[model samples]
Target: MNFSTELIFALATILLIPIYYYFTKLRRIEKFFENFPNPPTVPILGNARDFRSGPAFFKSIHEYTRKYGNMVHIKIGPIGHVLLASDYKFLEFLLSHNKLLTKSINLKFLEPWIGTGLVTANGGPKWKTHRRLITPAFHFKILEQFVDIFESAGNILIQKLSKESGEKSVDIYPYVTRCTLDVICETAMGTKVDVQNSETSLYFHSVKEMCRIFLARTTSILKRYDSIFRFTKDYEIQKKSVEVLHGYTKSVINSKRKELEETRKEGNYSDVDDLGRKKKKVFLDLILEATVDGQSLSDEEIREEVDTFMFGGHDTTATATSFILYCLGQNKDVQDKVLEEQEQIFGGEKCPKVTYTNLQEMKYLENVIKEGLRLYSPVPLFGRRIDQDVEYDGKIIPNGVGVIVFSHGIHMNPEYYPNPEKFDPSRFDNVEGKQPFAFIPFSAGPRNCIGQKYAMLEIKCLLSKIVRNFELSPAFPRHEMILAPETVLKSLNGVKIGIKSR
Candidate 1:
């Protein structure tokens, strides 16, 4: 009886192959769907349900690619997701129209958190205008000025960590967040909140809470549709928290506006803010610098850009730094290479000024940062809607429907990097012949990260300074902390590591 039962089960497994093929072919014949490069999805809800179900993404995505080809199509309800897990096609599509494809607006969750900033703004005139207006502020020469703020903040962080170095392990999450908060405050709002030492600054805390809520609550349909849940706990927290942020920004803008009046009167017209007070010469001043133009952005517009930069400019870079440290801790050979690179650059010397030029000098360091981004991507996926009917993959992806792309799959494809799981930076070497879209840490094309130069500068400085003194080790297992989905970015188990002076 047992032998007969086993024989029947084996026969059933063989029979199912044709059944599976018939269904897959039938779905294609239906033509409303496509295949994605991952494990066989459960149809309709596809991989979306798996992601929404839990945090086994690294394994899930890997499993899918092994079964399916490099690029897979998935449908969750009416939504279409093109998981370009392979390297070449992903890069081709991304780089070919970096401005259009790299610009994502299909997701429902980002609307609130990003509002109208670079990350979530629509791609046409509004973005162009905002991008144009804000471009001058981040000009390389101008960004060079912000390095002092980053360096100063970096030092404060080092000092605090130095005191706690003997500690078994430290939550570098807050420390890194503080460092970035300090940068944004000085760069965006013109108010230098020293969050480095006091991790609980009001705005800083609010930003964190808001980011947490936004990620937890944003549903894809709502951003595409109008199903935003006003009463939900996630929505409520995000709305109130964003309001707090807006209110603070308004106060700052008001002060700047008043001071702008005084400066105009004085004729010298050096930057100032409301209440006739002096403020840090930051991005706020630069935005207000052009308020005289009749076409200046509205207060809402200004705030949106500010909010966008605050989240976009800082969070991913922070994650990148944290991941870099994690990778360094795990791979001692790579870490040693980094340390050797650092020592050569700053031999027995104090932390450098961290100018734009210094960042270019640290080529190996840049590769390390890129490798970290690939493994534990800050944003594992980016979504977009085709504004007009466009031909893609020999099919017309009709306008207005949602389309999602996966970096988690794209970066891990063996075609782009050999042994995609390993932490290797050499792949980025002689990137000249590399396909246009293969590597996009900050994205590519017109709408890519505006403050990328600023971000790299800060990363280079922090790494240089940190490597000069201490070696890094992992906080704990990377999987222990779940990746909390947020409006802006991702984080892992609070990336704690032991710190010791070299």
Candidate 2:
């Protein structure tokens, strides 16, 4: 045979083997899936066609749920069986299971950017040790120190918003994103990138691009494989983003390491800033000082944790805060209640420096934030790999399958929250009787978000400042954000709102 024919034969052989194995595996698992409802699938392509784009995948999942039951089985070609579940009982079982801690392959897309950080790391000894060491960094006392940073960033946000405060509709997402970026940089690295003041932020832009690329690559089956993805334009963008993101993080790590070495040798290490004021220990500082089994973490390990926090901290909180503001704009009565609660705490002070005690006192505002999180979870979907056969509702979910917890579906389920569409803060007023996994904006159980408390505090602080100083209204009085399920929840049409000085 000629060389060209030989090459074609070799490639076909390589592809055919996997195809054959997947078909065989499908036959073995198809029996379990037979008991579950799923959308109609093509013979070999299965539902793979529906996942060519992120929006399509998101829309199809919802459509399938509406047509099928809450738990919909799907076959996506070689990716294998997936059970999209929003049932709270199944969710509680899946999330709380000690053995079901391995994340699915879908999240493997993030490893290039974050590199097996806590979020993407499987349930193993390293995850357990890292979790143990990092948990202390988010202690309530430590989180209290970041409140000043939150207030400082919130002040910058309010000033920027003041410039845009008028009859004109303003897209608050970018402003909120910058504020959260600034806050994360200062609190996570003890470095100020000043994202809010800069007309453009490279780190901010790179993070956004990375998230966009992840969503795209995740939904496209071909793009999920590095060999194929490397040939695409999205891969080029993703590679550039990683370079920018990792370069910035590595430089910060080197600088902090050098500073620690010098200060410790001099016996003059001080957690005090200029003006003789004590400085708060950042997440980087904690990681730097941490030692596991009598050996400190390497630079790469440190970078992984810092990048994870930086990625986790900014965008998710910013999205939540923006949606909370959007929720407030949509419901004037709820905003009025939030304002009344804020008045009782700050005594009608306009954008006062928020305190931890003050935050604790704003009980009603806390419920508003909780209600906002329920309505628009920043992370709408996350999943775990089924390592072994598990029985739920007397049906077996076979091994080698992935189960994606549809958080948005759970939040919108009327069984969990009556009239789930309404923006009712009172629903959170008494969550004592609520199902544990029913309202998981931060997720639930062991692998839940470690920085959740910190996130909540920061959102509360920022929202309090904005609501205190401004009267918000929907941009069109009937304005509704077009929810787009990306790496983080987004509004395609923009989180537009009208703001006026209160």
Candidate 3:
């Protein structure tokens, strides 16, 4: 045969080998889960077409859960099969294990942005070390110090809102997001990044653009491949965002290190209270001070953790806070109840700040926040890679498969939460009585969000202040607000609310 014919034959043989193996693999998967319910799949693509981005993707998953009964299997091209477990028991089985600690390959896309920080790190020695080293940064006393920052940021937010009170429909999202960004920056890195009031900031824009690109890439099968994605405009934006965000973190890390060195050299490191702890050790300071197994973290490692916190600490909290406000706006009676609770705490006190003690007193407000999180979880989905075969309800999820925990669906499970669609805060009144993994807004098990308490404190501080200072009403009807999950759950239309000064 001629050279051209030989090349064509070689290419055909190469293509046929994978095609044959793909069919063989598909047949085996089908036989393994023959008893289970699966959404229909087509040749090569499988159920890839069913998984779209944002609200539609979530809506489709919910529909599948309703029809397929929680544990549904889906296949996406050459990436392999994903078993979505919306059932609480399955989630418990998946999350409670030490071996299944590695995030799914799907989340590998986030490595470019978050690196192998605590949030995205696989469950291994490195993750254990990072978790152990970083846990002290969120000590109760440390968080208590952060309460002041929360109050300061909350005050700034209230002041900013007061200017627009009763003037027009204000989109509370941007304001709350900026405020949270400020709080995280100050508390996490000891840097004052006032992106909230700035008309334009490279760091702020980069973070926002990165989120948009991240979400787009995560949801699109076509964009999942690095070879294809790198050529796209989204990749360009993502690259710039990483540069800006990482550069910002590096600068802050360097500045903080210099200050620490200066303090040590000046013999001012003696600045400690009776507890023998530094008077002020922000998250970065703690990381710098930390030694895991007698070795301190390098500058790059410090930056990774800082960037992880900078992204996770701010964005998720901001989205949750904004949604909570939107939920309160939709339910005026609930808003009144929250305000009443705030009144009971602050009682005719002008310019009251949310003290740590005050946070404890606002029990009802806490439930309100919990209920909001249940209805609108900031993180709708959690993905995990199945390292070994997982058996659930007599079905075998073979090794190397991807498992997705649909947090939103779990929160909405009728079996767990009666009248799951209702906005009743009383559901959380007896939280202990409910299933352990049913309402995982901050997730469950070992890998649960470490900053959850901090998030709650910050949210309570901000919401208590805002509800006290303004009467919030939804600018649009409750039913009209479309929920979309882009990294965090958000309203497709901005969270617009009418704010009247109280």
Candidate 4:
């Protein structure tokens, strides 16, 4: 062959090797799951066509689990086999497995935005060390200090919503999201962006756009691969979003570091501030002081964790808070009970300083939030990559497969929850012998969300403020929310409700 012909042949051989090996491995997985239940899939395309959109994928997965049983074997284009599971027993096994701690490949989509932060880190020494270093940051003492920030943000949210009250209807998602953004920014990074008041908040808009891009990328098979995705418009959008996100995080990290150094040099790094009150340390302060592998973390490392915190800290809580408002709006009885409890605690003080002790006493409101999370988990699904054979239902689930823990499905299973469609906070009132893994809105296991407690506290504070200040009713009483699957769960139709000053 001529030089050009030989070069083309060599390149083809190089590319074909992986393809040959991939199909060969795929066949083995196919054989292992030959008898496993699954939806009807076309050849080559597998089940890709069924989940061509985010909403379709989310709806279909739930349907497939309900029809084909809890454990459904699904094939997605060239991505190979995934064990979609909603069974509590199977989820408990997979999530608690010591070896199955690695997150699935789907999380790679978030890497551009979050980098290799705790959420995206694989199971290894690095993950362990980072987890160890970061765990203390969420101590009760530190979290107690965040209540002021939460209350402050919530008051701002209530003021903004006051203008919208008495209108036909208003979508509470944007208002709640901006409020949570402000809380997370100040609490997590010790910087106040005031997203709720800022008319042109680049970081807030970028976050929302990035979530949209993530949903778009997941639904389209062509966009799953970097080679094709980079050529698309979503990639361009993602590139811009990442620049804003990363740029903002890096700047915050640098500023925080300088502040830390100044404090230490001034011999004012004691536990108390100039006012003699105990100084509250933000999450970023802990990260800046942390050491890994006998060395202090670099700015990039600090930025990764801060970015992860910003992403996880705000969006999930915002989604949860919005859904809780929707549920309360739909069920006036529950709302009244919550308001009564708020009254007993705050006692006619609208938007009182919700102390940690006060939060502990809002028992009924806590259950309401729990019920909302049960009905509408912010993260509907999360997955893990199995590295070894797993035994379930007297069958061996071979290694090298992805196991998706369908939290939404588990929450809706009538066996675990009677009349699962109904919204009842009382279900959580008595949980003497309920399965622990059955209700995992923050997931279960060693890798469960570290910020879960912080999230709950923030949600409670915001809900307390809103519920105390306004009387809520559903905009579309009988209409259901059109669920859209994104990094955080969102309603495509917007979470709308009617509001007026109480």
Which candidate achieves the best lDDT against the true structure?
A: 2
Best TM-score among the predictions, by candidate number: 4
TM-score of each: 0.82, 0.92, 0.92, 0.94
User: Looking at model 4, which ten-residue stretch has the lowest summed lDDT?
Assistant: 476-485
TM-score of 4: 0.94
Model 3, stretches more than 4 Å misplaced? 1-28, 42-44, 272-278, 390-396, 476-479
Candidate 1 segments whose C-alpha is farther than 4 A from its true place: 1-48, 52-54, 78-87, 98-114, 219-228, 269-281, 291-294, 350-354, 474-492
Q: Rank the candidates by lDDT, best first.
A: 2, 4, 3, 1
lDDT of 4 at 466: 92
Residue pairs clashing, model 2: none
List candidate 2 segments past 4 Å from native: 1-24, 48-56, 269-276, 391-396
lDDT of 2 by residue, 1-502 (tens): 9999999999999999978976766565778777789788888888888876556777788788878978998887844788899987788888998878998787788887888889989989888888888999999989989999999989999999999988898999999999999999999998889989988788888988888888877777688888999999988888889999999999999999998899899898677776898777899988899887887778998898898998889989999999999989989999998898888877979967678999988889889998989988899888788877878788777777778889988888888788888989898777876687998998888999999999999999999999999999989555667777887888887898999999
C-alpha local distance difference test of each model:
0.68, 0.87, 0.84, 0.86
Cα TM-score of candidate 3 = 0.92
lDDT of 1 by residue, 1-502 (tens): 6999999999999999878855754334335344333445575776666565235554555566667665555545533444334446644564456445434544335556557666676677777777888888887777767777878888887887787675377767667767877888777887767877674577787788766655554444453334556655566677777777888888888888788778788886444456665434678878877643467877777877788778776677777777677677778798888878876776766565566676668899888877887877777766655556556677754444344455666677677778988999887778765665766666566756788777877877777677776777765434344664354345555777777766
Mind giving the per-residue lDDT tens digits that candidate 3 earns over 135-162? Answer: 8888788888888888888888888998
